[model samples]
Target: MIDFCNVSKVFNTDLLKKDFHALKSVTFNIPEGKTIGFLGANGAGKTTSLKIAMDFIRPTSGEIKYNESLGKNKLEAFKNIGYLPERPFFYPHLTGLEFCHYMGALTDLSKAEIESQVNVWAIKFKIDFALNRHIKNYSKGMLQRIGFLATLLHNPKLIILDEPLAGLDPIGRKELKDIIVQLRDEGKTVFFSSHIISDVEEICDSVIFLKDGEVVFNGSVDQIMKDNIKPETRISYFDGDSLLTEVIPNNKKEEYLSKLLKDGKEIVSLQAEKPTLEEIFYNVKKN
Candidate 1:
């Protein structure tokens, strides 16, 4: 688990020049064993928060604590964390297997352990056949898969993935989602950033929405949807071979239904359109 307490990051580090506040007193907690999505538009500080959490960059005015009982040593905590950046760089000359072995060594895994773990993840990601190929020859999807495999090779307790599904095809995305679900089932915590709202909706138990370098929302996805539910329900009916539709406030549904029946219009269908994550995201951003 991790906590960001009043965290703020200012780029340019100067008062005279135009300074950019990447994070504005952001505060949140990442609970254990939960898949959390960091959602934001460009320049919303999603990546900045993740970088601060990972200690890639120091926060300007706040503290990030990870499992306080584990002590204040960041490297000790990082040993249990696996991270994949948005655009992962790979060794061009190393084959996939060679790269995995190289990274696995950094985690202090034995050669046998590295090979076994790599094999398991390779099969899971369907990249077994390509492991012998050179990294420079990999396509975007293949590179992403290899990068993902490297991230999981050590089986870290917490996985931090930045845009894990970026550039992946539909199948690749589905495969990654399935793997993420498996990790969650196995009780591993997953924190990821994504531009794809639908994927976040499908995979994240909780989501954090950022706007203008601030936290706009942070809670369960279901609760956010419920809180932002649309106030109107739509009704469709037929009036002498002509179809007509009406949007009525939720409280007036019964009244409108009664009026439609009294008017002698044959009811075609009646349904309430649920608010989607995308709609809720835009609404939050607009506000």
Candidate 2:
């Protein structure tokens, strides 16, 4: 489990005394065996939060707790965590296989284990054929795959991916999304941050929305879907329909619900509406 306590991060510049609060008193817990999508804009605190949890950066003011029944060390919290940053910085001289092997060595994996894992994930990421080529020669999508393979070589329990599908073509994005879902099915706890709403809507068990360095929403997709409006028929009163006595006065409380359920018989839609993820996102921001 990971917890962010009263977390806040600020970056300052002297020119205008600009202080961008990346996170604002944010607190959330991710349980085991769950896949979560973190959503926010370009300058939002999504990266900051992930970095703090991964111990890549210190929070300006707050506490971060990493609890592992497996007794993973603080600095070694990364041992059980797999992370792929926005832009992976790898040695231009190293081949994809060489880089992954180096990462495995860094994690203290034995030669046999390293070789087996590297080959497996490389094939899965479609980088096995690119193994001998220098990383500098690999395309953007191929680099992303190599980065992903490098992260997963250690077989971590928790995966943190940043914009994993950022620059991929449509097919590449779909394949990557499928791989994410497959990872979760294998019981690996997954957490990813993405600006793409459609991707999140499809795979996330739950999401926490950040806006201006604050958590604006924390709930399941269903709650987000039905957040604002009640599930009832909308009535536009007709001139001859007795001006709709179905107002059901509040003083008579029991009668209100009864009248609503009984008399809300006819309704029309501006269109056959489905409160999609985009709609829910709008509701969160609007509220």
Candidate 3:
């Protein structure tokens, strides 16, 4: 398991003479074998949290700790981790195969092992053909595929991806989503950030919604869907003669709402009044 203890981050801008609190006292957790979707708007400090967990950047004040020291080896912590940045920087001149090989080498894998693993994932992602082409010629989706293969070559237990579905066609998006589910089923912990709600809804077992620099919610997707904390529901009938008060009574609002929709009995409109992640984030900011 990973823990973020009162983690906070601030950035200083020389021109403005002001500080930007990218994250403020943000804390959350990712239990093993679970898929967590970090949902938020742009500049929500999701990236900062991921970076801190990976040790890419030290927290401004707080610390990130693990359950067991993965030995005294610093890189060993990475042994169980695979990371893909929001926009992964690649050596443009290197071919896709070369890049994977390089990452494998950095992880201290044998050359033969790199070749074997790279071939497996590269084939699965259908990027084997592009493996020989220079990365400069790769499209955004292609680059993401390459980055994914490189990250998975070591078979890490934890995978952290940032906006991985950013620039892909519909088919590609579906394929990657399937891959994420496959990994989760294999008992690997998957953590990623995305602005795509449908994707989050589809693959994530739970989510951590962030705004500005704080965590607003951390729980299962079902909890957000039920929205029991602030219960609300909408109902409408097709008949113009039907009065609003008759179709919707405050006392029976939620119960009748579901019953009417499912029974398909002349219901003109229906809406579940649960707050979306976006709404929740804005509400948190508002408070």
- The sequence of per-residue lDDT tens digits that candidate 2 reaches over residues 35-136 is 888888778889889888877888899988887742477857778888899867688999988898898998889889989998788778888898999998
Top candidate, metric TM-score: 1
Query: Where in model 3 is the C-alpha error above 4 Å?
Result: 69-73, 228-287
Q: Residue-wise lDDT of candidate 1 within 219-286, one digit each (tens)?
A: 99989878876788889999899999988889999998998899999988877756889988987778
TM-score of 3: 0.82
Task: List per-prediction Cα lDDT, in the order shown.
Answer: 0.90, 0.80, 0.83
Question: Which pairs clash inside model 1?
Answer: none
lDDT of 3 at 19: 87
In the range 1-287, model 3's lDDT, one tens digit per residue, is: 67899999888868668888999998887888899999887898888888898888888899887645332345667777888998776999999989988999998899999999988888888899999999999988898899998989888888999998877899889988998999999999999999787788889999998877888889998887677434444666754566342334456786786676676557666555556655655566687
Window of ten residues with lowest summed lDDT in model 3: 240-249
What local lDDT does model 3 show for residue 167? 72
| Best-matching candidate per lDDT | 1
* Model 1 misplaced stretches (Cα beyond 4 Å): 13-16, 68-72, 234-248, 255-271
Best to worst by lDDT, what's the order? 1, 3, 2
Query: Among all windows of ten consecutive residues in candidate 1, which has the lowest summed lDDT?
Result: 68-77
